[model samples]
Target: MSAAAAVLREEIGGQPAVWRALVARGAQVAEVAAALDALDPPLVRIAAHGTSDHAGIYATYLLRALRGWTVVRDSMSMPLYYGSPAARPGELAVGISQSGETPDVVAWLERAGREGATTLAITNGEGSSLARIADHVLAIGAGAERSIAATKTYTGTLAAIALLAGQLAGRGPQLADALVATADAADALLDGLDAAVAPVAAALARIDRMYLVARGIELATANEVALKLTEVCYLGAKAMSATAMAHGPVAALDADVPLWAIAAPDATLPAVAEAVRRARAAGAPVIASGPAAAALDGAAFALPVPVVPAEPLLSPLLSVLPGQAFAWALAGAKGIDAGAPRHLRKVTSAA
Candidate 1:
């Protein structure tokens, strides 16, 4: 094993013991809808655990776009110390906790319920405090998320949210097929990870910073990867919109910087491609991960995967893998402990 891999192995075995249950639970999108059905009207205001808020934000955006419902995306800040007091009454506050028992999340929802908001907990823990107090519960089934950085659980939440949105939109059958197919695609993508990891990590190691750029849903995945880079590898990486990168972030680019462009099969791919070109002109090394595997000039690494049809809303889930693998491999290369980040506790009690 590489030094980074040894660190990972020592910190977190190859698989989190939680994954078995999470995978099985991720298979329970049907149950998630049933729980949603039980609590109708006023919609869900989603809050996800800290460091994992991007998934919840993307999921909330997808829900609002698909169902025309009001969706509030709350951040889980200092899980035991900070809480949102602006939540309105009668709304279903959905808390997404991979650990189920994060003190702030559990306490917030418990308080939300007491204040007349129906609490629905989406978590891996069936017996967790949030689950117990929730008026309704939609378990994430992401199993045990052992790595201090979440991977499978984030994907599982995307899948669950997609299913929930489809059900609310009355497109259950189509969504069900899409969910199964997405899991298969994720599996296929995971199979190719070994080949993709080395070059991406090597390219990353050569540079001091990376700009993860993409459009629409993929932008959120970019942010997630950026977060992982900062948290796990302590790297200077930023995730930004393709358009925003041009307006300002692009100005900071230089030859040694690496830009990781996330390309989607959607209509926005052209804009994403052009952004990569602009970044390269600034002398930054570029890498693109997408369906076409279109070898742009200086594009040192490409992940080979088919462009399967996906809901525009769910595209982030597919695009997330390459970045996730990139961050994990980068963590290993730098000898950072993936299971535990420096000066960080799993849950926060300090404000």
Candidate 2:
């Protein structure tokens, strides 16, 4: 098996363990909500790179929903690079680093904090440079993630972001309850994932490229799936705004290419469903991964749980697990050692 796949077996061991983490994540959200009240910044900024971009995006959406504070979320535009150059000096800089030592995140936050902005580092490492540099620190209780693909850390980050979002919007009670609800769903979906394994595995051996399509909050889930596929399975995967797919990438599909549609319980589902039909008519193998029950010409791997509500912008968390499981299965099938990748280290100190 690929190292990445091995890590899944080692980490999850079974569906119950994974489900337990999801359950605790709900409680963690309440804790996170309580923590965010301490940082009443007029402006909030999420500064992150690589896979942590998912966290930044989630935080941005959640904050906007819970507290009307203006949020600026940044992510690397290219590999091994910092985020967008649109960093403002007035906002609270929230830096996210799994190892807590990404040089770009560290450098940006350090500079921002030095410029008089309150900085917060959300990380698993309590002793990393960011933890030491930021004015405040929110530690993710995901424990050690030996696998490089970042399963638990990603979920933990989302939980932390949800809490921050709730606090900023003065929706602490609502956000806490939402987290608990989402976690319950996450656990049920993880425990009953067997229903998806067969179809996911069937698609893995038959396709060359994977296209994850979604709109609105579902776009974040699409991005996370694409990242997991590329990072662990070492495959070619792309995420597109469902409408954007109609313009260009749609021309590149065929039966050899498999598409995964992110169908959420929202208005965007109709358009995303149409996109799946377009790909299928062009002879592409498509899989639906969301709350939707059926697909026109493809298989639908519906989650065992229901979708969560979070103002339209926060729908990403509900579908994140299904995509994660799909990627994890593909990685295992290929025997790729997902804990590490080519020419990459856990920490980049060169910057």
TM per candidate: 0.82, 0.83
Stretches off by above 4 angstroms in model 2 are 1-4, 10-42, 75-89, 293-305, 309-315, 335-344, 347-351
Question: What overall lDDT, based on C-alpha atoms, would model 1 receive against the true structure?
Answer: 0.68
lDDT tens per residue, model 2, 98-140: 8898887887787777667777898878898988998777777
Tell me the deviation in Å of residue 224 in model 2: 1.1
How does each model score on lDDT?
Answer: 0.68, 0.68
Error of 1 at 17 (Å): 12
lDDT at 91 for candidate 1?
75
Which portions of model 1 show Cα errors greater than 4 Å? 2-43, 75-85, 292-298, 310-312, 337-341, 344-351
lDDT of 1 by residue, 1-351 (tens): 445344433322222222233334543555666666666648566776554467777776777777777777764453335644625676778887766777767777777777777777877677877789888676766555545666666766666677677877777667666666666666667777756776678656756677888777676777887887888778888988887889988888887777888877767777788888898889877777766447445576676445658454656666677676777777767766655778765533324
What would you estimate as the lDDT of candidate 2?
A: 0.68
User: What lDDT score is found at residue 193 in candidate 2?
Assistant: 67
Q: In candidate 1, what residue range of length 10 has the lowest lDDT sum?
A: 10-19
